[model samples]
Target: MHDFSHCQIVLGSSSPQRKLLLESLFPEANVRIVPPDNPDELEFTGSKNLFAIMRQLSQIARTKSENVTSQLLDPTATYVLTADTVIFVPDDFDTYLVLGKPPEEDRDGVVRAWFLDHYLGKTHHAMTAICLRVPGGTVHEAFVKTAVSMEVASEEMVDWYLSTGEPAGKAGGYAIQGLGSIFVSSIQGSLSNVVGLPLRETRELFERVVQNGDS
Candidate 1:
């Protein structure tokens, strides 16, 4: 286990899943929840390439870290970690579907219909960008891609899951770590990625910064 006692760790996210994972991974670390004010997630929309999307996510992480650190004084001994997760499915020859969180009001059922149409009988990618910023102004970042295959869900199953309100704020209308896990047939990469954070990659980045004495 890495010793995070040397400095305070600030998590720049409001997601409950990310918080849970981070705390579990670094139980001894002094983790603080200081979520950024604005995520500004819609910066890149015209690009259909997966790399472009991942890069956009990295940009969001950077922006979020800067937003949080700006509020702290003498943050030289603090490490601010920010992350973003995106789910995408190939739509056609040259485009993909970037699933956003369901609309809050969702008065017309568009969000619910979108969830049912796109996720059934499909394989999609979950890309997560994790960035770590040190006091020395060094930002170490990486993105992990996980391929997930979901079974063709019955209408009844979708209705039941959606009625629970679990998919409202999730990226792809499904939470692999929650009630939505039953719809997943297989996953080719880190399961943690589907849950919003890649554990191995996160540790690797933390260790890299620690080894370089940047954390």
Candidate 2:
């Protein structure tokens, strides 16, 4: 557990990966995972309008952060963090088909096979919307983007990876931090963004919020 003696930060995500990233980055800070309040129907559009998408994501992140603040936080909490992740491709694609974590890991084999046949030789954008609510009750946010390329994975190879169950419950049907890294031909931006959270930008936003906070 991280030390919460001084300040508090609540992470608005139930994802294990996001929580892990927070723990790794703020070893001496307090952290808690809060589920997203947005409905499943809420869509995240990213990397196209860049600015527009980021603005919208910041809004959503702010909304989610405020939800956490109003629902599950203490009066002393110094910060509340929320994030949203999205994947973009050239053509119309399935989000669950790409990024949704499976209900049953047994489907990982099928998912890997499907991904191997389709995602090879393609580059896609991974966008993360990170929001931080400060002690003064204001929201600070940022959008992080990363381009990821998948190699030509064979069906047998996909099946092998699927058997390992790494694709289950992972966004874009793969885990960049785990065995899924093998299929990545290249990553043009923040590698951690593809994994889940973008620590660099998130931290910068936090610093800005703290520095410019209402006095």
TM-scores, one per candidate:
0.92, 0.78
**CA RMSD for every model?**
1.9, 4.6
Q: Which portions of model 1 show Cα errors greater than 4 Å?
A: none
Best by TM-score: 1
Tens-digit per-residue lDDT, 1-215, candidate 2: 32335557778788888898888777534886667665553444343455555666667677777677777646344577888776655544333222444447457655654475457778877888887777667666677889888887677877778778677777667788999888889889998898889977876676666566541
Candidate 1 local lDDT, 1-215, one digit each (tens) = 66755657889999989988888777645788889877566555775887678778888888888898887776676889988888888878867778767667872265457556776787888899998999887899999999998898778887788788888788877789988898888899999988888989988888888888775
In lDDT terms, which candidate is top? Answer: 1
Error of 1 at 24 (Å): 1.2
Clashes of 2: 5
Cα displacement (Å) at residue 132, model 1: 0.4
Q: What TM-score would candidate 1 get against the native?
A: 0.92
Once model 2 is optimally superposed onto the true structure by TM-score, how far is the C-alpha of residue 80 displaced, in angstroms?
0.5
Model 2, residue 143: C-alpha shift (Å): 0.4
lDDT of 2 at 27: 55
Q: What C-alpha lDDT values do all the predictions have?
A: 0.81, 0.70
